[model samples]
Target: MPRTRVHNLNISLDGYAAGEYVTLDAPIGDAGRLFAGFDGRFIHGIDKADAPVTLDRVLTSTWAQGIGAEIMGRRKFGPQTGDWPDDGWRGWWGDEPPFLTPVFVMTHHPRPPIEFANGTSFHFVGGAPREVLGLAQEAAGDLDVRLGGGPSTIRQFLDADLVDVMHLVIKPVTLGRGVSLWEGLSGVEDRFTVETIASPSGLTHQLWNRNVPA
Candidate 1:
């Protein structure tokens, strides 16, 4: 069976996944420090060896591992709201997106699927978590479905108890104002057994997995 999972989601000590004032210029807001572990060389089609060998590198390198499909909120897809500005706007990613698998973007206003040359397609849909998950699972087939999010989307799946595994990277920073990952949900930890690993780079990796049913 294909499982729903979240990987390499970075959050601050203050519980903010992303900072304030998110725009096209600042997609992640003032939380640029959250991605300090990422190597710019890999993002620019440069030599992979130029990237640093750190725990972040190891985890980020496996972001798309075995992921057949992805589901993300509209915010993560872009800074657009209400109706799309233009049909020409595919997404923040260029012609070749990192996610080669099919991606479903959650939105109230659905649109025709956008196909890219690199085997990546964006399908906009409006529905509950289970409905969307069903669509993604059908597309994923035997592989896993990843919940790529901007906090709120992940929260919906978490609230619906649809996520099988979650990998969070807790950075040592604080954004006093922003969308929080753990708001309005209390006792969420009770559902999953968490394993924490401290990295030399001062970030902590936390893995949460639901208990297997006998």
Candidate 2:
């Protein structure tokens, strides 16, 4: 069975995921940019046939083998107002997006279906978190659905207890400002348990698996 997972999500030492002021140019904001690093190496590592052979192996491995579909927030998808003007804008990743599978984007605005190169397709859904996750699960088949976060989106799923697994990369830097990851996470510690903590490249990567009792 496939699980819903969040991967390579970076947070500052102060628990902020992104810095203040997010625009089309700075998607992740200031703090998040440093924590996530400018390089798209994480996605690049997955594009290869052979398994990743470096510090990014863990992330790359999950992306390559387990990913079947992707769910992202509107902000994570692109900077657009209302309905999409045209199909000219595929995504921030250009023609060859890192994801080659079906992608479900959460948005209030409606737009026609977007089909891109490879096997990527963007479907817009305007509904609750559970509804979107259900659709993503159906599309995922036997592979896990990747929860592409934009802070608020991640929090919504987390609040609903829909997230099965989360891999958080705690960057060494301190973002004194911006969106804080722990703002609404009042009960996360009681619900999720830390499974592993790896220190690769001086970055602390923490893995948490849902502890929902059957």
Candidate 3:
């Protein structure tokens, strides 16, 4: 069975994946201060890895293997409405985005297909979470579908008990307030368990696999 995996999901100590008002300038918000140690280029894995290549290895490997599709929430897509409406704007990633698979955008409003010069293609889906997940699974052939997110999307999946495996990169930085990772998870503790933990470069990478029986 193909599992749903969420990877590269970083969070701050104060519990924000991103800052308020996500403009191109302030992408991460206050969490930016906490993550100063991390090189943006390295985090994006945009280039080849050299010395202390563990971070590169982890990112490259994940981006390369076992991923067939991606699902992202609207907020992560970009600003909505205007001369360049939310639907008009492509993702922050430029002409050639790293992801080379089908990416389904979760949204309340539907839009026409937006194909990038790169292999990435964005399809907006409206309606229930189940519908979105179903579309993603169908688009993803044999490999797992990745939930590329902002916190709310992850929370929704967690709440619905849909996410199967998550690679949580807990950065050493802490944001007193911003977007939260697991803040709304008041219950459902039994739904997941930390399957593995690795510490590298002051960043704690955790793996949580869903606890439901196969």
Candidate 4:
């Protein structure tokens, strides 16, 4: 069965996942400190042959494995807000995006699909979390659907009980005010089987698997 999963979401000690605002200059806003230990090169999941063996790489190595399609919010797609500009803005990624798969970007005003030479393509659509997940699942086929998020998006699916697994990277720092991942989700942990692994790098990796009854 294809599942919905979120990976590498970094949350601050204060429960904020992303900064208060995002602009062209500040992609993730003031929450950049959460990703201070991240390396973009390993985004497509790390391989031992690609880099030195480390706990960070090993944990992130699961990012791209057994994943097909990705569903993300508009913010995660870019800093654009309101109606998209007429300007030809492909994305933050250049000609080729790291996610070499079909990406469904959630938006109030849907736009034409954008395709790249690689397997990556961006489909803009608007709908409920379940409805959007259906589209991604179809595109994913036998594989799972990845919820590439910016906190709010993942919270919706999580609220709907649609997310199957999640890997949250809890950083040591704290952002006093920002978009929080745990808002209105006080008891979300009860629904999942949880495990934690703290690295010497001051990062805590948490794995949350939905507790499906046998």
The model with the greatest lDDT is: 4
Clash numbers, per candidate: 0, 0, 2, 0
Put down candidate 3 lDDT per residue, 1-214, tens digits, no spaces.
Answer: 8888887777876667777767767655445664465544453454455645665245535644577788888877775633346444677887877777889988877878688766789998876777888888898878888888888888898888889888877776766788887777876567788854556566777778788786
Per-residue lDDT over 1-214 for candidate 1, one digit per residue giving the tens place of the 0 to 100 score: 7789998889999888877677889888788887775553342233367655666677666567678999999998888789887757888888988888899999998789999988899999899999999999999999999999989899999999998999999989887878899998788888999999998878899989977766
After superposing candidate 2 on the true structure, give the runs of residues whose Cα lies further than 4 Å from its correct spot.
Answer: 32-39, 42-52, 83-87, 196-200
The local distance difference test score of each candidate is 0.85, 0.78, 0.73, 0.89
Model 4 C-alpha lDDT per residue in residues 114-182, reported as the tens digit of each score: 999999999999999999999999999999999999899999999999999999999999889989998
lDDT of 2 by residue, 141-177 (tens): 9989989877788888998888888888788888788
Model 4 regions more than 4 Å off: 48-50
If the candidates were sorted by their TM-score against the true structure, best first, what order would they fall in? Answer: 4, 1, 2, 3
Candidate 3 vs candidate 4: which has greater TM-score? 4
Model 3 steric clash pairs:
16-179, 81-86
lDDT of 2 at 178: 77
The model with the greater TM-score, 1 or 2, is 1
lDDT of 1 at 84: 86
TM-score of 3: 0.85
Candidate 2 collision pairs: none
Residue 106 in model 4: lDDT: 95
User: What TM-score number comes out for model 2?
Assistant: 0.87
